[model samples]
Target: MLAGLSADYYTRLEQGRERNPSAQVLDALSRALELDADQEMHLYRLARLVPASRGGGGREPVSPMLLQLMDTYAATSAFVLNRTLDILAMNRLAEALFSSFADTDNLVRMVFTDPAGPEFFTEWHRAAQSTVASLRLAVGHDPHDARLTRLVEEISAASPAFRQLWEQGHVRGKTAEAKELLHPDVGRLSLTFQAFDVRDKPGQQLVIYQAQPGSPSDHALKLLESLSANYRDHEDADLP
Candidate 1:
């Protein structure tokens, strides 16, 4: 009945050491492993002995160039995030821009699970929908990721809003966005957002935001910066 394949064979199949499996074999294996779309693609590639293309300079390690670019945007908010919505890093501007996020690492979690998050987002419904769609896009790129699955389960369990949005099954591509942000310190800031993929990591994104020059938004940004600077100093003094 082929009830089970040996662990050794399964490992070889996953590692691409055993190639040229027939269609029937792959189907059976996929069924056995309960592979999803991305996992199925990975399996097909392995069966064909196709090597995954390397990223530009290799799997991304937070490029120095990107860090330098972020430095140049001191007045604008910017963050580097991988496909799974794991925040890799952020600039001072980003902290001031999305100040609530400074305390949390996961953007998705912040949007759904945090009590203060809803109030922070003026257009909370649209923001929540977009976040779920973006997560679906990430899943399309890497369906086998355990962290992604865990996040989905956690959020789905904790937030009915997340569950509803996720069930809609909307897929999306990376794109620029504009937001009307209302920060406690900044008041209201209309900002333009741009997202760039990290060349070295296929699904990573570098998100940057700029307010239109010479607007009240610019003044609001400065106020947020001053507030954050004051908080930072207070925290430092309280530290042992």
Candidate 2:
């Protein structure tokens, strides 16, 4: 009775026999369950008592202004990701940073299935955990999203680790974090990344990584920038 509901009522709610739970009841349940902000929002979505805050699935066009803004970060690695962790757009340095991966389309896939994942992320376990948590938060936003369903299914089938983590029920959104990467070309890179939600485009996150000024990682980032530029130039030359 922490939710102030009788056992039978709670059982009916759990069994889906009782539909149309009022907002007050949901709020009580959320409080009783000690759910976090993300989890609470997910609860509302699952109940169909609230509308999704953003699009459920599919890729959206990145704003041209945002693309130009990302281009301005010459030395930094910057990219935009949707709720499903799909890399919708990225700058040259960001692409170069993930160059070793066979695919850089999805963050969860990159962390779990990519062969380079274990080596590229210096703290592989942390990366895996955070990726799963982030996906969990996404699921809360739109549980019926077909693309997200397929992604979760594909990864769960392929990775026992992902399965284990998925069962843990952790929910979190991407936030600022310090990440270490062992780039194939640049060696170890200690970088700080910040995740910002795009105000105009809900479910889109802009992530940027930077190394401390005058640090070894900073020098490495400069080298990577040059390499990225040269590689892009070569690709352009090959187009003829």
Error of 1 at 206 (Å): 0.7
Put down candidate 1 lDDT per residue, 90-172, tens digits, no spaces.
88878767666546577898788887677777788878877887777655445566778898999999998899889876655
Q: Count the clashes in each prediction.
A: 0, 0
lDDT, residue 156, model 2: 97
Which pairs clash in the backbone of model 2? Answer: none
Judging by TM-score against the true structure, name the best candidate.
2
State how far residue 49 of model 1 sits from its true place (Å): 15
Kindly provide the TM-score of model 2 when superposed on the true structure, using C-alpha atoms.
0.87
Each prediction's whole-model lDDT (CA): 0.73, 0.90
Candidate 2 residue runs with Cα over 4 Å from true position: 1-21, 32-34, 234-240
